[model samples]
Target: MLGIVLPAIITAFSLLILDWLLPGITIDTVTASVLAAVSIGIVNGVVKPIIQLLSLPLTFVTFGLFSLLVNGFCLWLSSAFVPGFEVRGLVGFLVGPIALSFLSTTFGHYLLEGRTPASLPEA
Candidate 1:
């Protein structure tokens, strides 16, 4: 449970980056951004798998490219739940989520590399 916290926080920061990087996406407040991140996590954890399973045939037909739409759908669904967070148009629907994932992973990697339990204990 505690382990999940860092990734979620990282994701919120990544969303803030996305807000800066993409014009089609809007996150008005930090609190809204965090809520949007949590909403995205919930959608990914609870809804996306089911959608993936249902869309498996389409995914197979498209050689997995269709998974991008699925990912976009998840991000769109997440935005709907958080006030002041909006993902609009094709770029927001398609590219925003991919960027967010990349930013979150990169940030998480660098952050984790800098702070291990051993390093923390020393500091």
Candidate 2:
């Protein structure tokens, strides 16, 4: 779906912001960006549900903090798939994905689908 794929692509660019905002994480180029996006989407798609299912109790117990770990795992998994994208160590591994989740949530909420809150049909 274009809805999903395009947001994932945009998320790759958001990685640029994450790297800038934090440190020790890098995605070197458009190629790496695209690869990271696609790989992350695939990783999230295939792995996230399973992780969520397995961690459901923890998710409930922590009031969703474990979701951050799942997010970080997806980023670490993307690092495995993309050559030029790297998360240097544990700190970056933990912070990078959570930061990325924030960036993607902000950007995707405002930018993607070409519709703002003012333009949407009323509930």
Displacement of the residue 115 alpha carbon in candidate 1, Å: 8.2
Off by over 4 Å in 2: 1-5, 113-123
> Which pairs clash inside model 2?
none
State model 2's lDDT. Answer: 0.80
Expressed as tens digits, the lDDT of each residue in 1-123 for candidate 2 is: 555555766788888777677775888887888888888888888988898899999999999998888878778888888998887776777888877878888888777566654555544
Instruction: Pick the lDDT winner.
Output: 1
TM-score for each model: 0.90, 0.79
Root-mean-square deviation (CA) per prediction: 3.1, 4.5
- Clashing residue pair totals per candidate (backbone < 3 A): 0, 0
